[model samples]
Target: MSTSPPAGPTPEEMRDMLRAMTLIRRFEERASEEYMAGRIGGFLHLAIGEEAAIVGTVSALRPDDPLTSTYREHGQALARGTDPRAIMAELLGRATGICGGRGGSMHLMDRERSFYGGYGIVGGSVPLALGLAWASHYRGDDRVSVTMFGEGAANQGVVSECFNMAGLWDLPIVFLILNNQYGMGTPVERAAAVEDFYPRATAYDIESWKVDGMDVLAVRAAISEAARLAREERRPACVELLAYRYKGHSMSDPDTVRDAAEKERWKARDPLVTFERVLLGEGIMDASAIAQMQAEVDQVVDDATEFAKGSPEVPVDQLADQVYAQPWNDDPRGSALVNP
Candidate 1:
């Protein structure tokens, strides 16, 4: 998808974008360090090089707007205003975590900030986001529901169904596609028919746009426009952000499938570095200011790591507590109603 009428962001907005990207970068770096130290359990996916897409799309949304994302969602949760400490705690599976030690790295949820739980199943959250948009529409609210997923999810049948319904109903939904070059070990060319995932929206008669995910300003502009269309025009739009992940599909993989030269090329375009350069070029932030910002973010992540480490683990007896919503019939008052 494409749009015109481009304008540069103000100095303050540029600085804020840089700060947000910095926080994400530092947080992920810390998470990696802690994971290696055996603090974080379960599978962990890091959004190392895709900082711009996460911060930019999130910066465009209203605070009350709901966001749903795939399993690689630490950046999404942080961008949606979940506390770093809480996210770190959740990753460590501590009792003070976001989901109270139940939903770990892949399933962080903070309903207070309108961040819906990150779905582990591929393409599962697409329809869930559609339902959220439907609810917003039915209640006559101007809220837009944004759903983030990888390029791999584009081929999922459920995604197409959600797209069809969102377009047909004119639902206020924005499908943010973070096309980070590779889906696990498979490249887009190998897994998908068309490399340009944005045009897939054309099949459903929805508006779409493609942006350079490495450029924070470009992502912000594209998402801002798409979100405005979704809210005011009650339309569904898709944004395809071309980016790459520096890490493997998960923390366990070595990410050695790609050529060393190709990895180096993408590393040179790191979103955090790109945004910092943009800020310096625009005179929005000096080297000292940037250093100070980095220091603050580093401190925050350090504190978060300490908090997660000090947090107590969930008791063994409560393992089955949150598995099901309703209380078990072990209570005598409810025994009489059992069919058996």
Candidate 2:
């Protein structure tokens, strides 16, 4: 989908978007470096090319709105106002991390920012987000819940189930499908019956739209409209943002499955570059301002890395903590201790 040209964002907003995108880019780049250096453990999914989808959708959300995202969620959490240092620390599994070193890269959480979590399982958070929206509605709150997942997850039966429940309950929720073309090594065409995901939401009688994910402004406008509809009219909405991931599905995949020319084609439409061109062309920002924004983002990422490096790891003996609620000793008869 092509983006419609509006009057263009104010210089300040444009600059903010630039800073956010650059921060995400630099953060992911540093994360890759850290992962390779053995500083970060576990799966690391970098949203190198989908910055617009994260930054733009997050910019449209209310401060009190809750967010549930897939594993590729560093950008979303940062855009939702999670502290960069804390997020970096979480990636490093530090005791001072967001989840206190328990939930690493795939499980960052910050309830204070209304960021629910970064779920590892595909489509696992869809129902959770719906339940959050239901809670908000039951409390007579206007806050909405935004659930983000990749196109690969669109086929999950859980997603459709959540959509049905949200529609039936008239919940204030936005299901954002970040269609980045490929689901790991398999492309969307190979998995989804219909590549146009927005239309799939119509089966549940929800309002839906598709936007150009490479254009931050377009994504922001579409999501803003969707959020407004959900809040004011008590309607559920879905949006499919057409985007592409420059890196492999995870750090492990070399992205060899797709053609080299296709990768180059998507790279040419990199969200950061596309947005910068629009801003500069519209006279909202110039090269100097962009350079400054890049520098600021670089410093933020560098500081986050240093913070992660210095943060302490969880104690080895406490590794099993929080796996399940602490086992209760329900022996009311005062039975003697037994180590069977």
What is the Cα-based TM-score of model 1? 0.94
Q: Residues 1-340, candidate 1, lDDT per residue (tens digit)?
A: 4455545678887787788788888898888888899988998899999999999998888988999998888988888878999999999999989999888999999999999979899889999999999999999999999999999998899899998999899999999999997889898899998889888887898999788999998898899888988998899999999999999999998988988899999999888888888788878899999999889888988998899999999986675578654444555565524624
Q: State every prediction's TM-score relative to the real structure.
A: 0.94, 0.93
lDDT of 2: 0.88
Clash pairs detected, candidate 1: 1-208, 1-209
lDDT against the true structure, per candidate, is 0.88, 0.88
CA shift of 117, model 2, Å: 1.0
* Number of the top TM-score candidate: 1
lDDT tens digits, residue span 1-340, model 2: 2243334456787778878998999999999999999988899999999999999998888878999999999998889778899999999999888888889899988899999989989999998999999999999999999999999888899999988998898999999999998889998888988889998888899989898999999898888888887888889999999999999989888778999999899898888988889889988888998898788888888998899899889987676577534442335764224412
Task: Judge candidate 2 at residue 54 and give its lDDT.
Answer: 94
